[model samples]
Target: MRSALLHVSVPFVLCVTLANTSLFDEVKVDLAYDHYAERRVDYLPSFLAMPCNCLVNLAYIYMGLYWLLNCRGVKETEQGRYMREVFAFMAVLYAPVQWVRLASLRRAPAVLDQWFTLPIFAWVPVWISSIQRRPARWRAPGAAVVQLLSLLSYGLSLAHERGFEVALGCHVAAAVYKGACVQRDLGDGRTRVYLLLAVLSCAGFVVLKLLDHWLSRYWLFQRLTGHFWSKVCDVLQFHFSFCFLTTLTQRAQGKTASQEE
Candidate 1:
């Protein structure tokens, strides 16, 4: 996991850094407190200015840590652990990108906040692919290819005002389509529940964030804010994605073992 993180960090940093420059000038990013309906605390640090939304990021860390230690069978562990840890690491790494955006309110962190999201969502299909194929040999190389493409997909944002939205939409669609495909092929009742929850959570994540301002008009959302709930939904989706994928992997492994026996 450490080696994988290190390998990706180099190009990841470079890509986001490049995006922070004029290359991503046309990309739509929220840089002001006004963009969020949450009230900012004047006495607080920049990172904690909007306490509710900023602190909600901790959920991502907690979820990540929980899953990071959740290793299972020896056979499944070898291939499955890689996918799990990488996804968990992504959840852990994502919190700070969002917090930094709230704190520094800079173009770079904002760019990072957007750029990091693509691969995180794209990993859904990557994990699904591993389960659909020869897991032992194919997972690593296949993940590398998918993740690289996910990173490059951000280049779409350079073209139009809604380029990021278009790219994100594609990632979301691919994840959903791939997830349904896998669920149809291998999922049981429990896996079906997890997949449904994951899809609902993903939808909530997108919808709540989009309605940040509109929902703020209501008393229920004024304090917690739609953006805050959106992060909550985001964390839930990650958790369920883990549940769905690992369950599928374990089921496949069990089938393979029974066949060999």
Candidate 2:
């Protein structure tokens, strides 16, 4: 009904907008014409360009804060409090990290982006611990330790001229680990379905990202605008992952409340 319409219309509208724009043009060394040169826009980077990236960052900030507020309204379960704290910390980190990312792009160096990305990924272990119903006390410290170690490793990698490779490897590994944990802990049919969709989204995310890098060399892909398609996938992937994760969390919380009643 309304949800179905939204699901369909959003992508349709986005594709139309992207197809009409020049944002997906192959990266050029010339900064004036290449606003998105070597930059990854989360959704519709082709049409929305820098604005799209900025808007996405803003959305993350808003959602993180909104969810934190929502958590505050819920019955004060240990899990709820932990989730609120996690969300608050993430919101704080996300704002400055996004600003730094934007600044790095403007200056044509990804050092700041790499540095901030470490903190973002730090949320993974904590998130996983929460999902597993682990003690709340363990989550934040675990995440902080992981973040610090990741930052140190990233710095060393950069000094050795393998920064990007290390970051990419860590990112991929973290994603795989998160997905695995989610799948393993799925206890119901609905959760399993969500996990499957999330897995598909992850696959699409990786494939589209790769296409963005190498597909331009192919004649057919070039005509179809590889970069544009990749961005489309990026947008879809982000939404799908968000849907799966949030829904999964809501379901778990609902079950917890029911059991307590």
Minimum summed lDDT over a 10-residue window in model 1 is located at 70-79
> Per-residue error at 192 for model 1, in Å?
0.7
On TM-score, the leading prediction is 1
Q: Each candidate: what lDDT?
A: 0.86, 0.49
Cα lDDT of model 2 by residue, 1-261, tens digit: 233234323533443354235532331222322433244444744333444344555555555555555554545446545544553444444454444445444322234334444544445445555656634334555655665566555544435555545675676578557756775775467656755665575566457545654765666554344444544444444344444555555666676667769
Models 1 onward score TM values of 0.94, 0.56
Clashing pairs in 1: none
Cα deviation of 30, candidate 2, in Å: 12
Clashes of each: 0, 0
Deviation of model 1 at 221, angstroms? 0.6
Cα RMSD of all models vs. native, in order, equals 1.7, 11.5
